[model samples]
Target: MIYYLFQWLDDFGVPGARLMDYITFRSGCALVLSLFIAVIFGRKIIDRLQMMQVGEIIRDLGLEGQMKKTGTPTMGGVIIIIAILVPCLLVGNIGNVYMALMLIATLWLGVLGGLDDYIKVHRHDKDGLKGKFKIVGQIGLGLMVGLTMVFSPDIVMRENVEMRNVENSEVVIEYVQEDVKTPQTTIPFVKNNNFDYSWLTSWMGRGATAGGWILFVLVVIFVVTATSNGANLTDGLDGLATGTSAIIGTALAIMAYLGANIIYSSYLNIMYIPGSEELVVYMAAFIGALVGFLWYNAYPAQVFMGDTGSLTIGGIIAVFAILIRKELLLPILCAIFFVEDLSVIIQVAYFKITKKRYGEGRRVFKMTPLHHHFQKQGGIVTALIQKPMQAIPESKIVTRFWIVGIMLAVITFVTLKIR
Candidate 1:
């Protein structure tokens, strides 16, 4: 709202109001405002949650410090959601299609996560919402995002093609004649970072374009669902998900800025997505919210984000990458989430296979979700990889994982230059 007010004031020749015209200025303001809101109001929200008995239902997992976290206020994700939405509404350009899509994605996933947390807390169902229901919600969001990217007239991108100036012995990159809608995304370690989905369906000849869109939609659904689930699983530790998300958000903000700027896009030889600069404002808010949440959510956590924060954070990162045509970079950028996700899958699959063949469920890690495996003391649970007999401290484990996440973020950024 403040953004629109400033726009009106600028129309009336107000000197300072014109500052809002710069994306950097607006994004900076949004960041500070969101951080202020989250840090100032977070404690009060945690108090209210404790008063309402909205505590986590902890299962008896034998990991160190597991029981101690029981009854910590969950659903503190509401704080992050508020922090993000308020700043974006006040400072973001709501008319931009990118901004609209982000807002929609935030609310859609926020509500879905809120419902899951509600069931776990209020309804006393540890299982929370049924797996199928969560999948349905994720699918619904993926479908909406995919369709919007395809159908929204404002969501076109200007492809940057390289050229050589023979007379001057210089090389240059230029955008196509006009912005056109295409299912092209940035792929790392390639001569041309842009990879168009349409090429996969070239065998269809005239129908290849439609087939490409269908393929894109499926990819969207898969990415949204997988990343959301990965984040949910990674939320097992204090500040793990929140801190890692903030790091990823920072990288994404840079990517959005580059993709949206014609000069940077040309220099980097990446797709020029007009109007995507608005996403920088949104991401600024996102980073601020997570950092603020971390104030209470860090070691000896005062509050837990539950599914509410984790799912929304993951969804936001996924959609933002897709919007900027950098979804292909997620595997590297979100390496922590992916590794945590893969750990569980491998552990579960191995356990089931061993049980079926040998009549006893053998283990891979001492526990699933990788992080907990580090927290678990060896020999207590039968697992294959048990070199570290002593359990690592939770805080230390979290810090190490964060270090890994930071390294991954650096690698993700380097890919652009390396390519």
Candidate 2:
């Protein structure tokens, strides 16, 4: 690991060894290194996948440009996984609990996804691994993350309590006291952004605080499942998941930086998470990896990420937000993914409900997953609610969604200062 080597070199009077001391410098280095790895090695990985005949099994969706993607390589998520792990191992503090947790999450979900992809490609099952197994894996991951946060000594938060009064009955809150492990997370746009799960367990009386861990674990499970599924649904088009994930990663990087800085955390009246700054280094690597992978993934994708990248991306985002105590912001930051997930649920539920009453199945959108709905041909006789006058090109749809993701990222950060 470069970090330890440089750290030891400092004792030997090695010049510029101090660069590792700065989070900014280390993060920048991580970005560059990861980007280089993703782009340079992406081609080789794609070739290997091609040699192995690991290609995507495209289902007929009848959308424009759909067949063109037939036989394109899938499971390119290896590129991202390698890019992130290498940089973090070389430049990051491996001993930091947060870093360790992130590494585990990345690899854990990545392996699960890789397994699913393997089943699909080798076993010739388009359905891949059973749905129950995937849920079990996600639940397992959530359990690990939840229990780790509850029990880890290094995991803790600084509470922000109101300190002074301001105009219009507003009070400026200031964070105080030593960091202690708690089930508290930031809730945006509220005066005191901190929300503790123990409050929900007030019925426990004097022991309510202890019961908060139980409540928090449930919330972690829900967050992990929802966000990961949301991301998985969003990986439908070229550059859609990769580009949107890069945006989310960038916003998360800012949150990690601010949450770890005592001055910024106190000034913003947010919980201070010690050692979370290391997450910035990881996020930079994540962003770089996604962007570099996009070089080959955008428009007519040369390779697909399959569940390998999609599931890992989602899991990483969920875990990173949890570590920074900003999991509550996920709905706002990952709104696009949420909408995509919701569209399918809504459409399916509506169709089933209507079919029971009308003796025939109905539809909600031209197609589900939200993205395909936009690409569907505008026809008067279609089974669903069709609002768009005409079909949009796939490229335009992806770009527009990206623009929305960018907007959400900005607004997510803005909400912190808005209060």
- Top of the candidates by lDDT: 1
Error of 2 at 8 (Å): 0.6
- Which regions of candidate 1 fall more than 4 Å away from where they truly are? none
C-alpha lDDT values of all predictions: 0.92, 0.91
Candidate 2 stretches with Cα past 4 Å from truth are: 165-173, 380-382
After TM-score superposition, the amount by which residue 45's alpha carbon in candidate 1 deviates from its true location, in angstroms, is 0.8
Q: Positional deviation of 171 in candidate 1, in angstroms?
A: 2.0
lDDT of 2 by residue, 1-419 (tens): 99999999999999999899999999999999999999999999999999999999999988888998988999999999999999999999989999999999999999999999999999999999898998999999999999999999998877878765555766665666677888899998887788999999999999898898898888888888889989999999999999999999999998899889988887888888988889999999999999999999999899999999999999999999988989999999999989999999998898889889988777878898999888888674535678685889888999999999999999998888787
How well is each residue in 88-113 modelled by candidate 1, as lDDT tens digits? Answer: 99999999999999999999999999
All candidates' TM-scores?
A: 0.98, 0.97
On the 0 to 100 scale, the lDDT of residue 87 in model 2 is 99
Task: Say which candidate scores most in TM-score.
Answer: 1
**Residue 140 accuracy (lDDT) in model 2:** 94
Error of 1 at 360 (Å): 0.5
